[model samples]
Target: MDSMMMGAMSKNMESMPDMGMMDMSVMQACMDACAACEQACTVCSTQMMDCSPACMNCADMCNTMMRSMMRMQGMTPASMMAMLNACIAMCQVCMDECMRHADDSDVCRMCAQACQACMDACMAMKDMMMASA
Candidate 1:
């Protein structure tokens, strides 16, 4: 999924000024992580368990973050960084909530893992952007 999307994104990247310094691979990884996190959170939310609210919130944030990255035409670096921070924060909250029941629930455990991965990917994207800047 990411590979195909990345291919399409690459063409658009050429039109964005200073985007040559951005690493498409990192963006791809971030998008993939967001997609995975969204799926995990959605499934976890359906359990109608204690962490459902946080999972649902994280899912929404992940989807927004992924879409923002996809539509970067008017996005500034500062705005992107802010969005990444927000996504990371949401992921952290969801992970903390999910981890509380990880010992008893496989879905919670998987959701926690997905949140961690999404956080890591967002951080990586931020780091790459800073380095490029």
Candidate 2:
């Protein structure tokens, strides 16, 4: 993350009330992972592998998740949880498919890493939400 973005995120965290809402750190991590996953998935999709379907799906899902967080007021706790679950599932599917070709494809390996990072971020967000609740 860039220093400017880190500063903005820090400000946001400081401004937000600690009332079971999304944590900025967790959200930032998720956003970063989603962006990485999207990029990786796009590259992997261009490889024309059998994993293209999952890669495309994951790319779309990650983009949506990142955008949703950017406009997070539209989401309730229920919606947030549902979105996280969907994103995690999408990442899992993408990771599984990419792993099939990981030994032979650099794109697949990068995509799998991005997926794992995204999944971890989503899980952390869920855990934080539940703890705050």
Candidate 3:
């Protein structure tokens, strides 16, 4: 996200009751990672390999995760955590599947890397939330 949008999100988040004073930078990183992972998975899915199904599933999960993060209203801490966990799990599955074909396909390798990055970003977001809690 751009600085203006991020500032707007930070201001918005500060007003929320359930998610008070969140680290917007962490949220931004997570969102960016999710977007990148989603794109990578989408591209990888078109390769029609064994990992296609997993890639498609992961892309959908990442898109949902990003959208949920973008809309913070009505989202409880528990729900946010659940979403993060689900995203991480889906990324793990996609990464594992892609890694199996990493040697044969550069696209799979790139997708797996994106999945790992997304997992790490989501983990960081989860850790930040837990610590604040």
**lDDT leader:** 3
Candidate 3 ranges with C-alpha deviation above 4 Å: none
Instruction: Give candidate 1 regions above 4 Å deviation.
Output: 18-20
- Of the two candidates 1 and 2, the one with more favorable lDDT, higher being better, is 1
User: What is the per-residue lDDT of model 1 for residues 42-125, given as tens digits with 9 covering 90 to 100?
Assistant: 999999999999999999999999999899896888899999999999999999999999999999999999999999999999
Query: Please, what are the lDDT tens digits per residue for candidate 2 over residues 39-80?
Result: 999999999999999999999999999888766546677888
Candidate 1 local lDDT, residue 75: 86
**Alpha carbon lDDT of each predicted model:** 0.94, 0.86, 0.94
- Candidate number of the best TM-score: 3
Deviating ranges (above 4 Å) for candidate 2: 1-21
> If scored against the real structure, what TM-score would every candidate get?
0.95, 0.88, 0.97
lDDT of 3 by residue, 9-127 (tens): 78888778778558888999999999999999999999999999999999999999999998998689999999999999999999999999999999999999999999999999998
**Listing every candidate in turn, what is its Cα RMSD in Å to the true structure after a full C-alpha superposition?**
1.2, 2.2, 0.8
Q: Model 3's lDDT to the true fold?
A: 0.94
